[model samples]
Target: MAGYIKSPFNYTGGKYKLLDQIMPLFPERIDNFIDLFSGGCNVGINVDAHCKKFIDYNDKLIDLLNVFKNYDLNEILIEIEGTIAMYELSNTSTFGYEYYNSNSSGGLADYNREKYMNLRKYYNNIKDNYDKFHKNVILYILIIYGFNNQIRFNKKGEFNIPVGKRDFNNRIKNNLIQFINKIKSSNCEFINLNFREIEPDYYKNSFIYADPPYLITNASYNEQGGWDEDCEYELYDQLDILSSRGVKFALSNVIENKGAKNEILVKWIYSRNYNIHYIDKNYNNSNYQIKDRSKKTIEVLITNY
Candidate 1:
């Protein structure tokens, strides 16, 4: 196995932590690899495959990924640094926190709040006119400084996350460089599409890996009925169709969380006799970290090999 390469985006529900447990279970040799519901692409980017396709419903995210795939690493970095200079955003990676009257524990949020807002406003305004590559460049920078390093948009289709406690430090820069290099070197494609629309039979000798929004978990994507019972059933239907076509697939989902159980998933998988590999997850201080462990949570990987 290759050394783990983390996704630069702090995406919610990412499988980065579980890669150690999950990747080893994947097929050793894959002809085509499809990362259905590829948020942040943590799993897809790390997989060794002849061809890789990252499919998602978020057009903006796909565009951003395309930017990473299509542009030169140095070009993207130059634009990012130029944007930072233009916005006068804090660069704690270069200047010490003491220079900004701040510290690592407190972060540079106080100094970057106003500047971040200005940058957000500028991005929202020029997003329509800016080229796809350059606009996504600004969007990437916004996400790096955005709250929790998340990519969020409002009902008006505007970037709405607030300034985070962190800045574009050296860690993020190095991660971005590696992510871009990985995308460029691999035979990868970014498609903005819903998982249901994909035709499983078209991808022969392929292995599909799905880490969709957990029906039982509460997250930003699952809020306001983003993913519901209907979506869950539809996904199951798609996976069944893939199985019928003899396509191998692995689905990562939580059947139980915080005292709530997904009876639908349990019934479906059991009835079909799918293989369920239990995942031992101890969420701590990370994004999906659960401080209260009083309630038992069960995560699993259901597969049709």
Candidate 2:
């Protein structure tokens, strides 16, 4: 089998790194893969399902996936290239390389920052009146160049992230190409919907993989009044209902974090026949630090398969 597939978007809580630990737990074959909280889509995109339905509460993310699914890659790339040329951000450009590195005082860094801010302003302005096709491409560019490569909007629903410390590089272009090809060939459908809103009948004979926001930890998207304790309970109740109906599911969550324990999660898992698998939460690849040393964080994959 090939190695891990990369996600186009740098979604903060993406499951790309955890796929190795997660994919093997899935059933050998799937008729339809339903991703309940498909953040970056790394999981469902990699799963060997005949068809896929990716649902997320984040509408912007669903929009991005839809853009890739419906638009031409070359069309999007042309806009990207034009933006790159306009900003003089080619790989060979010294200004592009040093803009995010070393100096922050003056010269290339300042110039690149100015260009980025201008691009952001232009994107924000044209968001309403610009061509829809071009808007998708422009939104893609904003995400890649925005602060921390996140899809964060202000209370006013405007893309409000500041200029990031990086530019459009070869890796980004390659990731975009890979994403376009994968999404195009993967037979996937993107839907913007909350987890609870999905109907029970829609999940018959399908395998669901949910990677929801950790109750103990905080993320940008976890805010905006989403994913609370009640939401977690509702998710568990839904999963229990599914299990009763013979639907298979695998959900990832943090059982413990930073000296705090998710007692509710612990109780729920122990109260049922769900299988629990411990996942290595560490991203660092070092033998020097043993598993026992990192006791503060505990991640688990709870499944009803």
Each candidate structure's TM-score, on Cα atoms with residue i matched to residue i, is 0.94, 0.88
TM-score (C-alpha) between model 2 and the true structure = 0.88
The residue-level lDDT of candidate 1 at 90 comes to: 89
What tens-digit string does per-residue lDDT give for candidate 2 at 104-205?
333233445667767767777774656777677777877876777888877777787776655566677777788789888888899999988887898999
Q: Per-residue alpha-carbon lDDT of model 1 for 1-305, expressed as tens digits?
A: 25988899999988888899999899899889999999999999999998999999989899999989888899999999999989999888888788899998998788999999999998899846668877999999999998899987877889899999888899899888889899998999999998767776656678999999999888877776779999999999988988988999999999778778899999999999999998877765322246555366889999987
Q: Kindly report which residue pairs in candidate 2 clash with one another.
A: none
Model 2 lDDT, full chain set: 0.79
Query: Where in model 2 is the C-alpha error above 4 Å?
Result: 87-111, 127-129, 283-295
Q: Which ranges of candidate 1 are over 4 A from the true structure? A: 127-129, 285-294
lDDT of each: 0.88, 0.79
| Model 2 CA lDDT for position 143 | 80
